[model samples]
Target: MTAAGLPMEIRAEGLPTRVRIHEVGARDGLQNEQTVVPTEVKAEFIHRLADAGLPTVEATSFVHPKWVPQLADAERLFPLLGDLDPHRLPVLVPNERGLDRALALGARRIAVFASATESFAKANLNRTVDEALAMFAPVVARAKDAKVHVRGYLSMCFGDPWEGPVPLAQTVRVCRELLELGCDELSLGDTIGVATPGHVQHLLASLNEAGVPSSRLGVHFHDTYGQALANTLAALQHGVTTVDASAGGLGGCPYAKSATGNLATEDLVWMLHGLGIETGVDLDRLVATSVWMAEALGRPSPSRTLRALSHKE
Candidate 1:
């Protein structure tokens, strides 16, 4: 049995609660930026995130530089990552070539993406969803054989850019494929962030009934429709613990033209703390890290709470 005197155990409060945080600012947040952040800068950013108590940080993406020129330096960037104790940095691998590069660099974890909406799939991958999955089967198997842990990012879980809304059945189907491919975790992304609480509840319920337990699911939401928080609550209620949040709400949604912010790590931590959920994060230190990145980018943080906190001190 574990020690009953554990300092931060959630059960100490009465009920058992556990939540996991997946930090994505370095990749998801930085990729959408117009300027190509220098490779050195990117590594340093990841270092700061690791210092901020983020256990898992999405360090970079291995897509074609032509497609997302921002992260063309994955091979070099990842090697430069400062040793943040106990922080595991995962990168996004889009295909076989990306996986090969990750393997070469001795990367232990990577993420692949797909979409449920046909039009969005075509727009994003230039192929139908089924065709893209076919292409990924070998890549996923190869990574697994190489002892690389794979995570899948399924975009447009609630709504899409080209398509209006994604049906629960379609999302479920795509998620099933990802899980079947041996992805250790499947991140449900609100690409356009039009998801509402009710929609999230329905989808989570459907997914649970369909046999994809909440434990295998991670929630990624943007604040496009200002509903990320609400959707997050719904997921939490369903026992979905892992959440993907950007430091300082760094990323913007390309599909949702008006969507300017991601769900900020600070804000999410605050809410989770208020809800009596334990995240094992240091808010003051995390805010400092976010402010540092925001300053490096020479932009304002989308995290309203962070902005206020900075001004107060």
Candidate 2:
């Protein structure tokens, strides 16, 4: 949306003074690295992110060690990050067992995922979409009973690797069931990051038509084709406020061969701040932290902002 005379970049949605950044670096970023980040380093990285005033950071995933060995220390990582305030540490629980382990380790917030495409479900979770959701239903129910907040992920929202473009109605129905089944919020994931502005606009429009309001939705995009930012603009124009981003553009799905890293935190914040949109995040500190994590893992950051900002005199 072009403002009256703002260079046709993006118009202000006049959103609230701030938006929450759900940092997925620790888990999402490191999980794909072949190098195992020592437990202390992982803990320290998480601590630094919290210290940077990033209100919510996804500490790590509690999936089985065999599935993602890097996050195998999910239990150890939690206590090591023990000093972090409790209200913001959201961990991903792959199933009931994952939730149980996370709860025992004192996680107050947890997340689970569902596939919008059947082939994605089969390949990722080894179950049909219904089977996967059925598996998650009890987990959500129990989490609600325990006063633990649950966030849901709906992967392949606009399109999928296996099934090609997904029906917008199917996306709406799954999202509605997730919210009705007790998810506090739903993140629409573009697994392969192939979503275009038209795809985003069409999906949101269809969702609104189906009585699915924008308030319940968050956007999770990959930068595979470098369309994440533009697609985000579409979501914002349509009134979807919350966004999920990973620091340094860290993390990609091992299963999706085409899945690139997530939208970079530094870059996203830069664009938002340029538009006078409040992300309540310090761009410098975030860039520093991304560099730290990248350094710890001995890899270069994927964030263009960090690269440019770090070289500032």
Candidate 3:
């Protein structure tokens, strides 16, 4: 039994025994912060995340400095990650210009972001759904030609802050477009954290029917409504193995009001370990890392598990 008196046996049925956590603390997590983190600090954060045994760590974004000034040091940041395996570091690229910056910095993996709703598309990317897809098509094609892996992020998949609920067909169509454009994986994002297990299962079922295998998809959830963990379980039950999490629950959506940050890595690790699923992350070490980051950010981590464990320590 764990210190919390919880049994160590796997709880969820039909869930994958091993889950690959795509760590997003350095990129998606920090981008929403008001503070412009120093490039050296960002580098250190990524290094510590990788040192904590996270297999995949999203390094930074290649967007214009005027847009996301928090990560404007992307050019300076990528080179500091020479110690990390190139395959394990992915940076977010906004368009061909962003892609070019990432390529110039020798990025081997990149992620592109799109939205499932028109309001989000206009608010976040300044384009319609089709326009954003059209913009990403050539980006993905070029990345593939350069032998770089590409991942697609579809935000507001569950519910949009401005548009309310998103339709399943629109979500599936965006997923199909990214896949057809040669993206290696697609991460469905609950930008506003309004998803329930039923919504998650229904969406996965729709994507499955649309011929998108669970293997090619990842789930990115926010804990705004405290439903991130539940939604993650639902996705795992539907056979999604790649899960995106931030180290300390460090970010929120600037475009979507009241949207909390990505799901915490510590919280996800606790649940996955309780389920007897392997994530190859040491729970104590991960918690300590998050607490350390909390100190850096001058606030407590938003993860319940981290808060509890850090207090105990």
Candidate 4:
């Protein structure tokens, strides 16, 4: 985009002036790693992300260690992030027990993961779609009583591997149930990265017609089909301001083999900056952070923008 690898600013019409990036590199990115990253390294990685001007960084998940062994050190890792604002650091909780763990660590913001399809619910959580929501009901209720901010993540909004082409009505129903269960925000995930721009627009419009405003929605897209950015732009056009991205494109669904890496934060920032949309991220610092983490992980990053910009350095 530039000789120095920065994009030239040109504001786009009908787009939000500022966007909130929900950085997920620390939790979602490392959860699928075969080898466990040191708790100290995880702490430093989160600190670096915060230093790079990420306003809301998802720190870690409180699921059972048996399920996600990589984050077995949630207790150790969360305490080390004491330097960060609790409000800006969100952690994922699978249920009441997970919520207890996070609340014990003074987590002010938390999230619950749900599925829009029955197959994924069975595969990921070993529960039916409604059963999973029923389990989350008490968790959400308790978290709300604790005065904690809650985010509900609805996966497979676009398509599901087991159930091809998830119905729009089905996704909207789960989204509404999540909200009724008292989630402060909902992140619609294109889990397998099969979403196109038009599909994204249609889903957002459907949600709006269902009484779910764009202000409460966020988009999480994977780059498996290379449509992450395009789908993101469509969400922006529909007035959705929050977006979920992993730094250096580092995460995928552990249960779904078809799902690939998430939409890279650097790539998202590049497009947003080019469109003159503010995300408050320092591009240089973010690139450096990703490079550092890549070396720590013993591999190169999967992000095209990370690769392109880091090559210049």
CA lDDT, every model vs. true structure: 0.82, 0.85, 0.89, 0.95
- Give the winner by lDDT: 4
Q: Residues 1-313, candidate 3, lDDT per residue (tens digit)?
A: 2466332666667989999999999888888888888888888888888888999999998989898999899888889998878899999999999999999988999999999999999998999999999999899999999999999999989898777888999899989988999999999999889999999999999999999999999999999888999999999999999999999888878788878788999889989989999989877777778888788888888888888777762
Clashing pairs in 3: 251-261
Q: Candidate 2: lDDT over CA atoms? A: 0.85
**For every candidate, C-alpha RMSD to the true structure in Å:** 4.8, 3.7, 1.6, 1.1
lDDT of 2 by residue, 122-172 (tens): 988999888989999999999999999899999989888888989988888
What lDDT does candidate 1 reach at residue 129? Answer: 94
- Relative to the true structure, candidate 4 reaches a TM of 0.98
lDDT of 4 by residue, 1-313 (tens): 3467988899988999999999998998999898999999999999999999999999999999999999889999999999889999999999999999999999999999999999999999999999999999999999999999999999999999989999899999999999999999999999999999999999999999999999999999999989999999999999999999999999998999999999999999999999999999998999999999999999999998899998883
Q: What is the lDDT of candidate 1?
A: 0.82
Q: For residues 1-313, could you state the per-residue lDDT of candidate 1 as single tens digits? A: 1232122323223322757889999998898998989888888878877777778888988889988888888878877874543138888887999888877877788888888788777877888999989888888999888788888889889887667888899999999998898888899988878899999889989989998998899999988778888889888877788999999999965444645667999888877766667787777788888888888899889897687667662
The TM-scores, one per candidate, come to: 0.92, 0.94, 0.96, 0.98
| lDDT-best of 1 and 3 | 3
Q: How far is candidate 2 from the true structure (C-alpha RMSD, Å)?
A: 3.7
Error of 2 at 309 (Å): 0.4
In model 4, which regions exceed 4 Å deviation? 1-3
